[model samples]
Target: MRLTYQTDYALRTLLYLSCLPEGKLANIQEIATVYAISQNHLMKIVHKLGKLEYIETIRGHKGGLRLKKKPEEINIGALVRMTEEDFYIVECFHQQTNRCLLSPVCQLRGVFQEAMAAFFRVLDNYTLADLIQDREMYEQLFEQKLIEIS
Candidate 1:
């Protein structure tokens, strides 16, 4: 039930934006360096997030990325749903090409479904704000003191 690195990067990107001062912008390269991640991979995530309207991007000088919505407006569950295309917890969970012989009477499939639902249900309880509750902690972790965003 692990999220792909793409989704992981998206979440990290969003959290980083949310941590910034209001109206401040962060460059993709700066964020990549702070997180010790590849700028190329994060560029894709940033593009997808921009298309989803979760963040806004500016071009030219003084251009970067910023959170378009408030942290409380960003639902973790919905974000995961958009980033994660496949939710098939088991072979029986998928409708297409589910060759499970026990598909007709598989209690295991239902159990897995319930667990996955529960996973999202719990995630639904949280928003980006919840994850960034400890802004000071994240600030320390990122150590982004030099690249000041004015």
Candidate 2:
């Protein structure tokens, strides 16, 4: 049930961007520093997010990153699906690679599927805006992190 770091960072990056004042942009270095993540790793996630049009990037000195879409438009479930490589919670989940002998009669596969569906069902109820209901709190926390880093 653990998400990959890619998904984790992507969400964090989006959260950070959402907390910014209107028209303000943030750089990868600042984001990486804020979360104590690697700049190199964050770069890849940023590139993916940019390609996905989740975040728009502006280059050069004053250039930075901002969300292309409003937080309300960013669905947590949709983002999770895009960021995750696969939903293979078990060996039987992958059709081609599944070698489990019990897969043919396994009720557990259906159970897992139901669990995954339930998981997404909950996530589908939320958006980036929903995650930041306490937007001011998140803003203050990020500000404190920035101060600590400095």
Candidate 3:
């Protein structure tokens, strides 16, 4: 199953911040430019993340955004869970679904549930730190540009 754009951006944003120097802040515009995403859309994800306390924002001069906690402190599974609202693998899994004829007999739900658990298990294995540890490689790939403060 593919994750939503919001989830994708959220992950990218988190990873970007995790890769930055400790206590350093990044602006939303810079993140958008680096990731090649729309500033408007990124803002929405950033707001949601800020609300979840995954990232914090500061306004005005010398202000930008930073991860609220260290990379190790963030859980990948939990982060995905926070960003992704709908995890239903099939129509039958939803609450408002029209009943499928095989709802009672089909083992598909259980199977899907197991698969979902496995997906989360894999994500849980990696923390934000794990994703950002290859700092030099990522810096080369994205060519991170630091903003100059006057």
Q: Rate the local accuracy (lDDT) of all candidates.
A: 0.89, 0.96, 0.87
- For model 1, the superposed segments whose C-alpha errors exceed 4 Å read 144-150
Q: State the displacement of the C-alpha of residue 71, model 1, in Å, after optimal TM-score superposition.
A: 0.3
Question: Against the true structure, whose lDDT is highest?
Answer: 2
Q: Write the per-residue lDDT of candidate 3 for residues 31-70, one digit (tens) a residue.
A: 8988889999999999999999999999989999999988
TM-score of 2: 0.98
Put down candidate 2 lDDT per residue, 52-114, tens digits, no spaces: 989999999899999999999999999999999999989999999999999879899999999
Candidates sorted by lDDT, descending order? Answer: 2, 1, 3
**lDDT agreement of model 2 with the native:** 0.96
Q: Residue 122: error of model 2 in Å?
A: 0.9
RMSD of every candidate to native, in Å, equals: 2.8, 0.7, 3.1
